[model samples]
Target: MSKKAYPYVLIMPSVLFLLAFFVYPFLQVFAQAFTHSEGGLTIAHFETIFYDFNFLPSLKNTLLLALVVVPAQLCLAIGMALMISKMEKGRDTVLYVWTIPLGISDLAAGIIWLGLLDQNGFINSFLFHVGIIDEAQSWLNYQNPWAIFAAIVFAEIWRATAILLVILVSGIGLIPKEYYEAAEIFGANAWVRLWKVTLPLLRPSLQTALILRTLLAFEVFAVVMILGGSNMPVLMGEAYNWAFSYRDAGAAAAYAVVILVLSLLFTLFYLRVLRVPKEAQI
Candidate 1:
């Protein structure tokens, strides 16, 4: 076989795998979202989800969580990556410790946080022993939505920042050391070098990390469900309730579509904003 034909032949299995799994399932869900049970196409499923009492709150919570978590994780990851990049010793050890959370499943992480933040959990127990509170406080409850939100945000940051850090650290390693030397010779301080040399060259990695983290943020479910329950509604949680609790597949598909659209929009936004010129690429 010709070389070009051989390349396509090798990729044929992957192409078929995608068609059988991702593309096929996506098309089915999309069709289910837009079609009526009676036969004809209709927007009834969309309308049902849109008019549901929980819809607005779910959308707001999802957006707010993504807005808060993504930026916080990004900032923390960047700081950690820079620190690791500059470390003269035990870098691998530090990186291994930091990335331990990546091995943890989302539900497991949520459950772990729940054990800490529950009314009778470690935080309240510690506070009680220290005479800070007379009793175990109900932090993850409907009475205090803000506390629940905070717990979820904290859990997410703890669990996912390593993802961004690993990506950024790899990107930083690719950068030529001579660039920093030149910047230093020109009287650039560490902060100035970071801004001028590191960030500009790191745009490609930033775009990748942001887009990935943002998409996962939009689909956050297990952590929110574990930490907030019905006290704080989120898109993915609502979708699960509709699909399982309410037994409404169409509404669930509609919610999935909304999530897909949001992911696409933010992905496009990052692509546009962090567009790295070909000339600037390493």
Candidate 2:
């Protein structure tokens, strides 16, 4: 290959990989969303999902979950990352312990929390033993929607906050120490340093982490499935029900397309809001 053509030759494999995995699947989902069993184009699937009893609730629950969980995770991750950043000894050990949940799958984390929160599980058992409750509580029951929702939120945050932490920690590490020294020399407090120096410099990483986490939050399925089942409606859970339980491929594809659109929208929003100038980036 000519010198100028060598770069394209090197990139050919990546271009082919994206087309096969991402581009093709995306187009297929879009096609299926509009295609009917007879192979004619139709809006029946979209109409069906819109009219379904579960559609609004599922969308609301999914949005509420992300709205609640993402902010909570961001706050927790920031505090955790800041603390870890300040540590002079055993920082690696502390971070490793905190990130252990990252090694667990979503379903596995749900199951673990389930054992603790279930009626006959550790939480209720311990509470009963301590006479805090006279009977085992059904915290994960469909009757207590709040409890079930809280459980899912707890599991999700516990399992996923490590991701944000890792990203933020690396971002913090990349920030020049001279900036912090100068702030300290100016008699700035920790809070001032965080607000002025740390966060401003960390915008790019924050943008990347928030976009990635928000997208994954929208696609949350396994945790909700294992924890709340059908009692707790989420977009992904509803999509699964429509596809496998109801055997409606078209409806499932519609759900998938909606998810893709929402992910793209949030991604664009983050990019726009967090647009760091090239000169400002480290």
Candidate 3:
């Protein structure tokens, strides 16, 4: 087929899929957000989702979790990638062990953590045997924000780090042996070689890891609900409550749109920071 014919043929499936699955639902949600039985073409749904104090708290909580988790994941992933790349044996075993959590369901992980943090849970049982405490403390129900934050951090890190690890490893593989060999011959120690060669070479991979992990952290749902409970605020959980519990689809759609916009903004900000040059000099 000609180029013009090929473009339409290549896009036809995607266009059909979008129309069938995406466009119609988006239109419905947009209509609901904009219209009311009494008030026509009003922004009340968005106003409620944004201006409401409850929503702000949820939004704030989400941002806080993402900010804390994303950077930590990237750092840990970098270390893991470097270590795995340098390993002469059992590298596959270590990679499998680390990524095993990726296959574990978020809800299952939450339930597992609940058991660990519960009153009569294994941790408490062991500590009691060791005479560490007279009774089991409420690790999950602690009034301190750090308690919930810690659980969120743990869950996010456990599940998401593998994605970064895989991406980083792929990037590391593309860096030719000659580059690292050259660095070694220049009297560059392991740390120096990592800084000058590995880190620079991994910039594109770093950007991808950051963007994906950051967005997922922002919208963390099942684990948060299971570990932290609905008493605490997180954007997606709050949106679920609005849509299902309260039967407010408009508000839920508004919240979803807000999250989508925030994700796009973050991507733009990261691209600006990376500012990848045309030449593959890195």
Candidate 4:
């Protein structure tokens, strides 16, 4: 093959895989979302979802969860990454321990939290034994929306912060030691150096991690289902309900499209806010 053609050939498998798995399914969903079951294109599916009682609450919950969880995770991950970076010993062991949650599936994480938060579970058992409460409390019930939301948030943060930690740690490592040395020589302290030197240089990695984590946050499902159940409606849960429980493919597709649009808009926002100049990339 010609040199120009060889590059395309090298990427052919990936392209074909994306076309078959991603592009094809996306087109199918888009068509189902807009087209009437019997014939030509229509907006009925969108209208149905827009009019659904659950739609607004689900949308709000999804956005609220993402907003709350992503920032908390980002802060925690950055702090952990900095601690690991400064360690003189056992860094690998510490990192391995911290990332243990990464090996646990989302459902498993949710279940583990559920066991702790359940009325009859460890927290209540401990509280009762310690005379903190006269009896077990229904922490995960529909009446305890705050507790339910907090449980899901904590579970998600525990399970996913490792993703950002790993990315930030790698980005910090890529930074040349000379930069630190120069900053130190100029009398820049740790905090000053972090803001002036580290974070600015780490923009690319921040952009990447934020985009990935935000997208995953928007699509959160298994954990929410396991922890909050129908008490906490989210976009993904509503989509699943429409598709499977209600057997309305078009409505499900519309929910999926809403999620896709949100993801795309946030991605563009990150790209704009965190855009690194070509000259600044390490």
lDDT of each: 0.95, 0.92, 0.84, 0.95
Stretches of candidate 3 above 4 Å error? Answer: 2-31, 37-39
Model 3, CA-based lDDT:
0.84
Sort by TM-score, best first: what order?
A: 1, 4, 2, 3
Candidate 2, residues 1-282, lDDT tens digits: the string is 689999999999999999999999989989999999899999999999999999998999999999999999999999999999999999999999999999998989989998898887999999999999999978777788898889899999999999999999999999989999999999999899999999999998899899989999999999898889888888998889999999999999999988889999999999999999888777
The C-alpha stretches of model 1 lying farther than 4 A from their native spots are none
Q: List the residue pairs that clash in candidate 1.
A: none
Could you tally the backbone clashes for each prediction? 0, 0, 0, 0
lDDT of 1 by residue, 84-159 (tens): 9999999999999999999999999999999998888999899999999999988787888898999999999999
Write candidate 4's Cα lDDT for 1-282 as tens digits: 699899999999999999999999999999999999997999999999999999999999999999999999999988899899989899999999999999999989989999998988899999999999998998898988988999999999999999999999999888998999999999999999989999999899899999999999999999999999999999999999999999999999999999999999999999999999998788
* lDDT tens digits by residue: candidate 3, 36-96: 6476887888988887777877888899889888889888999999899989999999999
Name the top TM-score candidate: 1
Residue 103, candidate 2: Cα error in Å is 1.4
Q: Relative to the unseen true structure, what is the C-alpha lDDT of residue 79 in candidate 4, on a scale of 0 to 100?
A: 89
Off by over 4 Å in 2: 1-15
Of 1 and 2, the candidate ahead on lDDT is 1
Better of 3 and 4 by lDDT: 4
Model 3 weakest 10-residue run by lDDT: 273-282
* Candidate 4 local lDDT, residue 265: 100
